[model samples]
Target: MTKDVIQTIKDRASVRAYKPKEVPEETLEKILEAAHLAPSAGNIQPWEFFVVKNQAKIEKLTEIAYGQEWMTQAPVVVVICTNPDLSAAKYGQRGEELYALQDTSAAIENMLLAAEGYDLGSCWVGAFDEQQVKEVLELPAELVPLAFVTIGYPEGDKEEVRPQKELDEVTTIIN
Candidate 1:
């Protein structure tokens, strides 16, 4: 049975280990579609995604990520880039400094939840050498590398429970 959105969000976890199996093309497409549908500031939608599947490139990316070897285990790694110029053209400094990153973050979150709904494992990877990633991907200067999300069938059981703050501890609702 297909899981509901709330359940999917609740079940999502950062998976560092993955099996040798590859994610199906259709499933990957669905995840991408979810990201595409994410809300963006001023509808600029400045995010771009590079789906990395080639083993050689993945290995190079692992190096760029400062030897985060676990990332290479996933069959796919999505590099999220932001076109700051696009947002800047629309909203000036605020757009370039913050909105672009915020928009891309929303897209990444959508992809994470979609991966969980598909019964796939994923982890958001933000630590990496941006210049190296741009060079490896041959991206234009305007496209700034922001993050990476690795996806695959998990190698073992779900991640062990991690502590989280209660909603009241993290939120303040205004009357």
Candidate 2:
């Protein structure tokens, strides 16, 4: 059955385990396309993505993430980065301090939802040593590592749904 956007969003969960099979390049491209289309402040588009598929590198990343073994389960890990200078040039201090992070986050979310739409499992991993990650990836000085989104076929059935707060409980209406 085909799922709508809302259903796709609802289906997304932080998948920690995955099958051993590799993700196809075409599928990965589609997910990246969604990220590329994400909106950014002043259209500066300060985000960059690194698709890491090498087993050795993935292992290194797992170590960089403080031995988060689940990171290695996914066949692909996309590293989302922010080019602070690019955003700063366009939106000034606010862009450097906030907009760059915001833009990269939005891009990551787009990729996550797109992965869900493709019937894939993914997890957003933010806890990592930035300096180590930069060294591992050999990132330039201008690019700041933000997060890693691991993508792969899940090991089992759909992810277990966690409870969420009701809209009324979390929302505030000023009108």
Give TM-scores for every candidate, taking all chains together and pairing residue i with residue i. 0.97, 0.96
Q: Which residue pairs collide in model 1, if any?
A: none
lDDT of 2 by residue, 43-108 (tens): 889999999999999999999999999888889999999999998998899999999999889999
Highest lDDT against the true fold, candidate: 1
Residue-level error in angstroms, candidate 1, position 22: 1.2
Q: Looking at candidate 1, what is the lDDT of residue 142? A: 98
Residue 147, model 2, lDDT: 96
Error of 1 at 67 (Å): 0.6
**Regions more than 4 Å wrong, model 2:** none
**Overall lDDT per candidate, in order of appearance:** 0.94, 0.92
Residues forming the 10-long window of minimal summed lDDT in candidate 1: 1-10
